[model samples]
Target: MSLYQLVYYSRNAIAGDASVFEAEVDAILAASRRNNEAAGITGALLFNAGVFAQVLEGPLAAVEATFERIQQDERHGDVSLLALEPIAQRSFSNWAMGFVGHSAENAQRFAAIGLTRGFDPARLGGHKMHAILRDLTLEEEAAAA
Candidate 1:
């Protein structure tokens, strides 16, 4: 399977508040999983408060098509892709879609969050900043469900 690395930033409005944010997050994750499965894709999603960085693996065409749909999604109307390109590795092989949290320590490792302004396609400092949440297996998602 071909893999694509996609990264984007979202406004703070994406996470409006506690309860609403939880509900929205749940719904979005479910939708992502369904879409990925429908398109024969697998990937992990990382959220650093507002920004979203993801890696999708599947047929190249399927991955690109799904990303096109994502660009038009109203739920994340502010979604702005910083990068979309072929990748040599599949960071997530087992998950249809995974929304994993980056630890606070990891978040602080590469760059201070708020201080980092502007999204540069060449600056992949976020992923470099955290230890990815790939450790959560399908079993973990099921248990959470």
Candidate 2:
């Protein structure tokens, strides 16, 4: 079966403070893991600064359907669809919905991904956005390993 990848970024609905934001993120990851596991979706979700960037890869229909629901989700606004097309394989296959939390030192830690300029999904192009997401996801995997 052909695979599809959907990448997007949006402003966080609970961005004013850290405590609420962390709680919201935990809830999102838990729900996403449950849902994505059932749907056979493999992807990564990144929470950095005040934005959410995610990459969902799976069957064409499944990926598209999931993206539609994400678009309709109220917690996400100013959504920018970075990349949405076929892919040869899943970059996040080991995860139902892997997550990466950002901190003050994250920028320096992830500077190899060209994040030294800061992660601005709005200004970054599709290729660069995908690169960042891939790096973040792999970084998480490496950390776990």
Candidate 3:
């Protein structure tokens, strides 16, 4: 299967209590996992506050199809793609669907990789987390297995 990486950004507007938002987030993630697995695709989902940064890799057709399905997800709207590139490596060869919840520590780890200026708790939106996710696919590929 040809490997592909896709990136997207969208504004977060889930205005309510944290628990309400969390429940919605859980449902969205579950649907994503189901869809990807059915298509033989695997990757990771990184959610930081309201920013959704994901890297899905698998058969070219499946990658495209999965994104198509993602666009219709009610929890997310205004999706904007930042990048989509072909790579010569397989990052999550063994992961059917890996996930990460972004936090201060993860932000710091991303900064060390040169993807951003470093973890600034106040500037979470400014950090290039998607770049970090793309790099992690390879950086932690061994561990991912």
Candidate 4:
């Protein structure tokens, strides 16, 4: 089976209550992990400043199906597909669905790692968006190790 990867970003539509957003985020990530694992998919999720950037990799059909499901998801507003291409191998093979929340420290860390100021994907272009997320994930792995 050919391996494929999909990258995208979206805005959080979970508004009104802080508790509600938090609960929704938790449920979302949990369900993502479960679903991805069952489908043999791997990916990482980064949420910063109410924006989300993610990369999903796996079988062509599985990744495409997940992308379709995400498009219909109400929790994710204004979803933008960044990239979808065949890949020889997985960059996030270790994660079923790793998630990271936004923070000043993280923004600073990412900026220091070469992402442009603000780290907004819509402003970064697709190629640059993929680069930033890829580097950030590597940096985080280094830090964790």
Candidate 5:
């Protein structure tokens, strides 16, 4: 199968109080992990400053199908596809659906990386967004280890 990677961002539309939001995010991650693993897809999702950025890598058909489901989900709004192209390898190969959420330390790290104003995925573009998610997820993996 030809490997392909897709990068996208969406405005958070999960309406609720903090607890509700957290629960919804947890549910999303759980479902994504299960479905992605079954479909042989790997990816990382980053949620920060009311935005969701994700990178998905796998067979072209699987990635596209997964993305189609995401686009139809109500939790996401204004879902914009940033990049979708053939890739030689998977960047998040170890993860079915790695996730990184907002935190004080993460805010500081974003600022240090020249996102002091805020995390704007559209302006940052696909490559930078992918890099940020990849780096942050790796950091999380290291901490878990």
Candidate 6:
């Protein structure tokens, strides 16, 4: 199978209070894990109050199909595709859908990436976004261990 990687970002469109937002995100993650696992997709999602950035890697057709569903989802708006290309292998092979929320530690790390106001996925390139998600998700995995 030809492996492909896709990077994208979208504005947060889920309307709700803090708790509601959390619940919505939790639900999204649950669904993502189930569907991604079934489709043999592996990736990480980085989310905050303002934006969401994600990396998806898998077979070309599967990646495209998954992205199409994401585009049609109501929870996301202004979705922008940053990159989509063939890859040698998956960077997030261990995770069906690893999630990284905007905790204090993650916020600090994101600031170090050169964003002052907030986590602005629009200012980043696909490769940089992918690397940031990979590193943050690895840290999250280690902390959970």
Output the number of the TM-score-best candidate: 5
Error of 3 at 50 (Å): 2.5
User: Could you tell me every candidate's TM-score relative to the true structure?
Assistant: 0.65, 0.87, 0.69, 0.85, 0.94, 0.93
Shift in Å, residue 56, candidate 3: 1.0
Candidate 6 lDDT trough over 10 residues, lowest sum: 113-122
Who is ahead in TM-score, 4 or 5? 5
Can you rank all candidates by lDDT, best first? 5, 6, 4, 2, 3, 1
Q: Find the number of clashing residue pairs for candidate 4.
A: 0
Question: Model 3, range 100-125, lDDT digits (tens) per residue?
Answer: 65557677765565335332322333
User: What are the lDDT figures for the candidates, one per model?
Assistant: 0.62, 0.80, 0.64, 0.81, 0.89, 0.89
The CA lDDT at 128 in model 5 is 88
**Quality of model 4 by C-alpha lDDT:** 0.81
Task: Tell how far residue 77 is off in model 6, in angstroms.
Answer: 0.3
Regarding TM-score, does 3 or 6 come out ahead? 6
**Over the stretch 39-126, how does candidate 6's per-residue lDDT look in tens digits?**
9999999886588889999999999999999999898799999999999988998899999887777777777776445656767889
- Weakest lDDT window of 10 consecutive positions for candidate 4: 110-119
Report the Cα RMSD per candidate: 5.1, 2.1, 5.0, 2.3, 1.3, 1.4
Candidate 4 local lDDT, 14-119, one digit each (tens): 7778778779889988999999999999988877767888889999999999989988999879999888999999888778887766566786765575443455
lDDT by residue for model 1 (1-145), tens: 5566655554545545667867877887899898888888887766654556566667789888888877776656566555566778765667888775545554563244332335442354435422233444343566678
Give lDDT: candidate 3, residue 112.
61
Output the worst ten-in-a-row residue range by lDDT, candidate 5. Answer: 111-120
How big is the positional error of residue 102 in model 6, measured in Å on the Cα after superposition? 1.3
